[model samples]
Target: MVKFRNAAAAFKALNGLICVYKPACVPIQQIQHTILTNLCRDLNVLPDRPHEKRVEIVGPTNAPMTVKLVPNYADNPLVCGPRYIKEDFRCSWATHLGLFTSGVLLLGINQGTKLTYLINTARLTRAYKIHGQLGKATDTYFWNGKTVEKSTYGHVTREKIDKVVAHMQAAHQKTMFEMSGVHMESQTMFDLAAQGLIRPANNNLPVIYGIKCVYFNSPNITLEIQAINEYDKYLWTIIHDLGVQLKTSAHCTGVQCIRQGKFDLDIALLRKHWQLEYIIDNMDQCRRLMEEHSLILQPKSAILSV
Candidate 1:
């Protein structure tokens, strides 16, 4: 673990990506504010934060004989205000997780803010473990939304669900090539697919590289999906579509992003660890992760290997 002599040193060291596990029902902006507020509070309490220096006039009315520079306790952070505020830090997220979605969220601080753009443009794949409930359909395709319809899920078997998932995956795979902006008949398409998952040239288009049903019980089902440029609604709609394919109704119970590119939930900071020390350590770990996977920083090919 890297140590800092002072708060300033620690603050300065916060110049890379940090992963946090965002809880459900909380807005991303609130999470950002909380993290920044914690950082400011923790940093201000650290040692070596000197009071502001002020020049004290020796002679008052007539003439100033000697002017002595003294530490101004009145202007000290404790007296006036905190030296740092949430606004002092430049923090940005690489991806926008929905208000209802939760899990690994990557944030870039200060100099690392530039890297967020790179990550976005790189079109890195994100893995999600989505939970769905059978016999329910909502207006928004999620559990929180208004229930629009419901149906019997007794006929929905594991084999039926797996078949639907396989069909969905195959359909998305075919669409991936079309959206990739490559000639279907050309050899380039084969070469790219042969290498690995071909990233869509258009970053705005959501592409699902892989999708499979990981867990399945009568009324509950879980899917493991790897996709890029996806939105929360898109993922939720997948559950809705799955229900339709199976001749039943379903709504997404939860959406958890397990991984994004090289960053995974294992290294993500929980709410309790969103302090200065943990943030600095997380930044260091992120730097190491990037070093180990240089392709994350600079992609040599559009193939999504990572």
Candidate 2:
């Protein structure tokens, strides 16, 4: 772990990746602003912050005027302004989560922002544990959205859910090759499929690497999905489509990203811990994880390294 003598040192060392847990129903921009604000606040209050210096005339009207420079309490941060502000730091997020979706969010700070491009280019797969409701459909595909349709869920079973999930995974895997711009009967396509789940070369295309029903009960079902280039609405739509596939209607109740690349929820800091010390620690942890898993920076292969 890196140690700092003062806030100035800490601020300078703050150029790296950090993971944070974003709560549901909160805007991503708000989280970014809050984190940056907290960083500035903590750094400004730390010890060894230099006061603004002012040059004052020492002797007046009597002898030769002498000028001296001294620390001015009036110009101190408490009176003038904080040494750091939200604008001073540049924070960029690798993945974008929707307002209703919460999970592990990866952010790059200062020089770390450049790493985000590599991460995006790598097309890392993300895992989401989505909670969904059966027998109901919403306009926005979320449980909170206005209900548009309702039906009975008694016919749904765990076995049937698994079948549908398997079929969906297979269909997506086939689509992966189709979208890869490779000929369907070519050996290259077969070789790629034999290797395992192949990510789409185009970053804009959404592909589901894997999906399974982790938990199930009447009216409620939980699905754990590993996907690439996906957004909140896309996950919600999966639930809506699953309902259609099961001869019923369903809506998403919640969406939580469990993992992104090697970064997992365990490493994500909560809102309350967004302080300077915690952020620095999180950054170090992320750096080590990346170093250990160098494939995260490699963009050549469509197959992600386990």
Evaluated against the true structure, the overall lDDT of model 2 is 0.87
Candidate 1 per-residue lDDT over residues 54-117, each given as its tens digit: 9987875777588799988898766888878877899899989999889999899999898887
Error of 2 at 141 (Å): 1.6
TM-score of each: 0.90, 0.90
Once model 2 is optimally superposed onto the true structure by TM-score, how far is the C-alpha of residue 205 displaced, in angstroms?
2.0
TM-score result, candidate 2: 0.90
Error of 1 at 238 (Å): 0.8
In angstroms, give how far residue 224 of model 2 lies from its true place: 1.0
Q: Model 2 over residues 1-306: C-alpha lDDT tens digits?
A: 455678878888899999999999999899999999898888877776666688988786879999889888897767767778888999898878999999999899999898876787776789999999999999999987999999999999999999999999889877767777778899987887777667655566788878999999978999999998898889999999999999999999999999998999999999999988899999988999999989464545555222
* CA lDDT, every model vs. true structure: 0.87, 0.87
Instruction: Indicate the TM-score of model 1.
Output: 0.90
Tell how far residue 299 is off in model 2, in angstroms.
4.2
